[model samples]
Target: MVIAFVISETFSIYSFNGIRIQAETWAEALMKKGHKVIKVNPWDKHNWEEYDIIHIVGPCEFLLQFTSSLVSKNKNIVFSPIIDTIQPKWKYKLVSYWGCSKLRLSCYNHDVRLAMKNIKQIYVRSQYEADYVHICYSVPLSKIEIVPLSYRISPCLHYPQKENFCLHVSILTSERKNVLRLIKAAIKYKFKLILAGSIDSEEKFRPIDQLIKKHNNISYLGKVSEEQLIELYSRAKVFALPSINEGVGMVALEAAVYGCNIVITEIGGPKEYYNNKAYIVNPFDIDDIGKKIELALADDNQQPSLMEYIQNEYSLDTCTKKLITSYNKIVSC
Candidate 1:
């Protein structure tokens, strides 16, 4: 099958969000499964109808407009709406259906009706996201497929060396990332913390830099190569990313496969993936974060269940199979 894995944008070689990485990963996974996959962005000039299925990869106003156009032509299409909002569900319903969208206040609201229009399938990263899509867009439960971001284990990716530090990988300056709060938690708990990933602005993140200098337990490594990242994950005792919100927390998933005790935000879908294995904490509470990190540090058993669960449930092969199954359903219709 020829597939167009479309996204709002593509990732740069140095920087990207979850959506870009997932799109690239899916395209590669599909190709390995004997399907022809094309990486497409909204601005790409190719004939989109040439593909067997139009698989839209993320949510944006422009992408919604393009998807609806394909829907009008009766084109076979599926969606990976990697979207979420911490705002009240009532606000979404009000703006989407009750004419509040015309005010042009909320970026999400103006295009939600368009986003909710005819599509054969909607794929999401977690059950929380599935519920969000259904509630916000009024999409049917059956229409949404939960395919969380995945990590496929291989020989080259190293194993658990288990050092005594907590690892966090994200844009350090992102307000939603909540890295500053996590730093405070680490300091409070007296745990060693290693910060990774690209910093959007050194100037904006100077406060964090100062904190790193003042506290020996906290240190930022900026960004590291894939090799360095795997090594860090392999060495770290605990992996923590207590963000304000996450679509599925792919970094945490990656860390879990390396056998790092997971301490992640409870706000998003990490709970569904980790289940009872990893430490789940409130993103807004510093003490909760600290306490959970402390608990995670104490879990020295290196229980094989969390690693096995992630490997079995979130393998790239499993993700591709579900995606292909959904693709077949839409194309057959």
Candidate 2:
């Protein structure tokens, strides 16, 4: 069977990284099972009828549109609506208006309806996401499946030396991610913090740069490669990414796999995943975030065990098997 995996937009800065890993893993896993898999982003226009099934990843309005067109032509297709918080408010509107007409979500209202119409089954990274998707799109429980994104265990990637510094790997975006709040929390605790990822522009991220300069413990490493990020994850004492909203918070999983205790916003995916393993705090309350960070950082028992758990549950092999099984089930139906 020839399978086409479709992704259009670069949804999350980290999303592309996670999807790339999953695609590579899926291709290998399915091929071993005697299936042909080809992964393509939305812009790559291919003949949908050529493949046994077309799998569409979320955040690609184009792919959603394309899937609807194929379904209209009576083509067999399977969809993985990889919903995340990265879909901004406006993009939702645009897709609702121009992409799929006469579609409205009885539960989630506008954007989710537009997102849900073209797909058959929605694949989410967590049970939390599955529930949220059900609420948002009013998708039936049977249509949603939980298949967490997988990570490759690379030897080159290293964690921080000890729990001396708080580590955050995020985009330079401020509003949704609330990076400034983290800077403030770091300042309040007077703890060392290292930030990874590039600024869209130095002028645009002036406030972040200013905060980094103001705080002696805050070090901004602009746009490190994958190798550098893995090394930082390996050595970091604790990982903190207290975002205002998140779908799965892949960084938390990556850090957890590296044995770094997590401190994350208590809303969305973080609240669901970090129950027993890490610390949680309110994203808006700077003081609360600070206190949690301080506690996690100060804990001496932080070990590599969390990494073991993540590797076993959310590893590439695990996600791939689940996804392939989901695909086969959907096709059988």
Candidate 3:
């Protein structure tokens, strides 16, 4: 089978581009399974008919035009929408009222609806996302497939001595990421916080830069490689991501596999993975976030080993098989 993976143009700027990572992983896995995979740039001209499947990852507003063009081609397109339902309700309402534009919304309302109508299959990371797509976009439940995100699990080479600070990994500039709120909570609780990932823009950088300077307990480690991230995850007592919107908190899953007690927001994605295992808190409540962080830090030893669970449920091999199964179904149809 020949497969083409497509992603938004802006994905290059995203430090933690989970969608791109997933697309590449899927391509690698399919290749190992004796399938030819090609990555197509969203903006580049391509012979769309050459591939058996054109899999588009992350259908945000940036890729709206590209997706619209793909839909018109009437090719067998599979989409991993990676939809997040935690956005403010007003944003949707604004899009509905004002219509599509580059300035107003990251994803145009009509583009999502049109893509859903034309796509061969819609792949989602969790049931939470599947339900959100069905409910919000009115996409049929039969069209949606729940395929959880996978992590590359390797044996810890040298476990670092555990540290007292809490670790967070995400782009701090995204409004939905809610890094500022986490910073405030960390300061309130007087807990040492280590932030990883690059700042998105100068506007978003200024406030966080000031916060780091003012608070001795908070440290920002610009952007770290995968190896360095794993080392940090191993060393940290707690890993927290208080995001208002998250597709599947991949960092938290990685942290959990490395044995850091997780304190994630009670959003859809993380809850599916960390049901009773990790501390879940409301992102909007600073007090709740602070309390949960403190609890996670204090009860690190009590947290169960997520290694076995992740390996069985969300390992690269397991998810790859699931994705292949979905692709086969689409191709056979």
Residue 208, candidate 2: Cα error in Å is 2.0
Q: Best to worst by TM-score, what's the order? A: 1, 3, 2
- In order, candidate lDDTs are 0.79, 0.71, 0.79
Query: On residues 187-268, what C-alpha lDDT tens digit does candidate 1 reach at each position?
Result: 8888999999887787979988888899988888878988888888888889998989776777888888888899988886
User: Cα lDDT for residue 308, model 2?
Assistant: 62
Each model's TM-score? 0.89, 0.80, 0.82
> Between 1 and 3, whose TM-score is larger?
1
Evaluate model 2: give its TM-score: 0.80
Please provide, for model 3 over 1-333, each residue's C-alpha lDDT reduced to its tens digit, 9 standing for 90 to 100: 899987776777865577778888788988998999888764677777677888888856644566567766645788887777766444653453344455644446656765565687889888878776776677788889988887665734443457788999888898888998999999999999999987769987899889999999999999998889988988898999888888788888888777788888888777788657778889999999999999888884634455456646777788889988988888788
Could you tell me which residue pairs clash in candidate 3? 61-106
Taking all chains together, the TM-score of candidate 3 against the true structure is 0.82
